[model samples]
Target: MQTTSHILMIRPVQFGFNAQTAVNNAFQQVNNETGVQEKAQQEFDRFVALLRGHGVDVTVIDDTPQPHTPDSIFPNNWISFHHDGSVILYPMFAENRRLERKPHIIGKIAEQFRIGRTTDLSDFEAKNLYLEGTGSMVLDRTHKVAYACLSPRTHPEVLKAFADATGYETVEFHAADAQGVAIYHTNVLMCIGDDYAVICLDAIPSKEERKYVEEKLKGSRKTVIAITLDQMNHFAGNMLQVQSLRGRKLLVMSTQAFSSLTPGQITELSSFNPIVHAPLDVIEKNGGGSARCMMAEIHLPGKG
Candidate 1:
């Protein structure tokens, strides 16, 4: 139940570097290449094709050019669709990212998915508190556990708000790089699949917190595949396990991530599900997010 066959993605029209996000996201490398947008579009198309080839149901929405939202392609940061027909919207850290939460995108999704109501948490923006949807927390949906790494973008009160609203338990810890700078988003450090969790325990500075997270993962009956800080930086931890329409479970990551994994690590993961990946160099270089961040799993009931 943690994985979904259906996913939502936004096709970027102006995909490029975002200065607003670069202030915090260490993974984002600023590039001034002439054909950055063109290359990103190509990568986006190929990633979508890869997903569809695996029998994954993907709803692609074209981003509007007028808004000039550079980070629109990473829609998982702004909105998330739930199985109970509740579409949850979160407050974004970057100002321009707020524009990515378009009413029309939700309308477009409603054509084939049933969205009964929406819970807007964007009001927290006025208070200067932000929670960038799944980027702030990698959810263990089946257990109703929200694992989060507290950062400038993720606030305690906002996490509390979400927990109160959705009846989910929040498991929070501070995550940082070797330089001690915050990692920006939780998904970059860990990914929670249906039966396993790939995490970088070294990222959690507090020893107590590291042990606590490990206990939680094990207590939930999940097989733990720990990745190093180096592997995590290469996007190895940013994976998602999704069931295909034909009833096969598949683990999806970027080619960069898949290549970063060791043979043993690959073998351990392959035991649970077959792996799927695609080239996303341009998108990851400019966006500071990889495969998992681009996918917003659509758990809504199908329209009858």
Candidate 2:
């Protein structure tokens, strides 16, 4: 299955503007640091409640205050859980962000799911090369492909290593924004669903690369729903499709992202799954990530 009902979320302890990520992440903005963590917590709780109300299984873990990790809320960047009961940790670009990975969190998850062998790719950080987990590479698990865009946070060597470790084919491409600046994460410009793909084709300037991506998606039986660069800025491409407890398909995104979608695009997406959105203005402004980034889908099997 491409989507999972179980998800892992990190409750913020000291959420604020991250200076380290702001270098490449243009979506981030600095708000008043005072009491921002409180506001972000409120938003996080409400978002999780909304997901739970929709019958999505969410595991909320409170973050530690000792590390002062501002972007700890986005756990998908540090670690990913797979259906094979394997846990893979990726190297983060920022020094402080690397501190987000804690063994205690994985141990907490192990209580519910049976975790197999663990793979640590954080050694690449010593070489100044990094690949921020799902943020840098969007996986099409069903097809065993990892779609990645090259950036400072996503190096080709690290991506190849990830592919080698996971047995996934690497579909590498370069993506840029309206101003021709490289996008920091592939998830910011594209998302892979079971039967469809939401992507900003304009971001891929190379016609051959764009064709390669489109052909691959078509080969995998996915309808391509292209969004413009403006819509991408609004985070329209940053969406996740998951199954509810009742087996209904739901596409999740931020309210801001949903609002930016065109009527035609909405209809196209609704043809595949219903839309579920929550207001994430505060989190998106401070963290540079949306609904998809907040929840790390847990594909690990439950303990028997």
Candidate 3:
């Protein structure tokens, strides 16, 4: 299967600006006078509905009411399930976000999928090293490559451990925000599709690093769809390519990311896959993540 029909998403109960994550995530807003939580929730609801409408199965889970996890809406960070029957738990940078790793969620998925082994990498957090699961690394399943950008929230040791455990090659590089601060998450600066990659080359300051990345993508028979830093800021690079129930490819992104695209870029991208977007202004502003952040693809082999 090109993409799994099932996707996991967490509905924000106390959704608002996360001060803990904002320290490393420059995209998050510091202060907002208006009540944007409801607006954000509406957007999340609409996004799930839109995906379901497209025949993409989505499992929506409401976050816990207590011990507020402001960044819990992005569940892709806390855990990742693999087709090989391995579930990898990541060490989150934010102390509050660590609460999102609920065993119940795993039990629920096990009802339909097989469970082999679970690797808990949360011990790294004790050493102040972290890796936010899929947020810190974008996996190229077909090629077994894990594309990652170095940041304070994403530790090198964790990436090495993941690559060793998952048997994926690590393609690491340095990425910085507009202010030259390290970009907190790899997903925010790039995404690798089945046969294409959307990346912000400008974010990589070193020519050698940029060239190496370019060469690596080209070597994999991938069409490099480059996005500018401005577009990356608009979340254009944070898109994911998923398959529908009908087995058709769907390029998913936030409405804000879609709007930032030029007609030419959109046309070029449409040649690869059909586009699917949902308005996520509130979530983007407050949570500092886009549609890709909200989804955690279930790659576990399902029952026949």
Candidate 4:
């Protein structure tokens, strides 16, 4: 299935502007250090409540202060859960972000889900070759396709390793913002849903690459809803489609992302699924990630 009802969220323990990640992430903006963590926690709580009200099963885990991981709120960067019971761990770009993956977290999740073989790619971090889990690649699970925008954080070698482990064919391309700076993550430029794709086609400077991406989306029978570069900067392209406990399809995103959409885009998206959005300015301004980044879908089957 393309979407899952189970979602994993790491509650902020030390959420704030991460200097290490800001070096490459263009979306990050430095804010007042004082009380930023508190505000972020409040936002996180409200976001979780909003999703829960929509019938999505969210597992909230508290981040430990021992490792002092400031970017730990975005758990999707460290690991991904597949329906095949395969748990794949990826090497994160920021050193501190790598510490987000803890043995205890895995054990906690194991209590509810049956985990199959584990594929650890953190060893690539030593060589400075990183691929930050789903952040590095926006996956089309239904079609077994991984769409990735190449950047310093997303290396070809690491992507090949992921493809080898999961048998997912990779469609690689380069995307950049209006100012010509490469986008740090693919999710910031495009999102692959079950029946539709939200993407900033203009971000791909090369006409050929842009056309290739469009072709793939069309070939996969996905209705393409394009966003402009301006909307992309608002994190409008970082939406995720999820299944509700009642078997409803829901498109999840931040209020910022929702507001940036055109009426047509929203209507087109609504035709396929109802939208679920929450205010995430505090998290987005400091952490450089929105609703999608905060969620790591749990595709593993429950052990009954």
Badly placed stretches (over 4 Å) of model 3 are none
Give the TM-score comparing model 3 with the true structure, all chains together. 0.97
Model 2 per-residue lDDT at 42: 91
lDDT scores in order = 0.92, 0.92, 0.88, 0.93
Which model is ahead, 2 or 4, in terms of TM-score? 4
Q: Could you estimate the TM-score for every candidate?
A: 0.99, 0.98, 0.97, 0.99
Assess the local accuracy of residue 194 in candidate 3 as a C-alpha lDDT between 0 and 100.
78
Please give the distance, in angstroms, between residue 7's alpha carbon in candidate 4 and its true position after superposition.
0.2
What is the C-alpha lDDT profile of model 1 across 1-304, one tens digit per residue?
Answer: 7999999999999999999999999999976778988999999999999999999999899999978899998999999888799889999888998889888999988999888878899999999999999999999999999999999999999999999888899999999988899989999999998889999999999999999999999999999899999998889988888888988999999999999999999999999999999999888889999999999999999988
Better by lDDT, candidate 3 or 1: 1
- lDDT, residue 22, model 2: 95
Query: Where is model 2 poorest over a 10-residue stretch in terms of lDDT?
Result: 27-36
lDDT tens digits, residues 1-304, model 2?
Answer: 8999999999999999999999989889866757788889998999999999999999989999988899999999999999899999999999999999987899899999999989999999999999999999999999889999999999999998888888999999999998999999999899999999999999999999999998998999999999999999999989999988788889999999999998999999999999999989889998999989998989999998
Tell me the alpha-carbon RMSD of every candidate: 0.7, 1.0, 1.1, 0.7
> Which residue pairs overlap in candidate 1's backbone?
none
Q: How close is candidate 4 to the true structure, as a TM-score?
A: 0.99
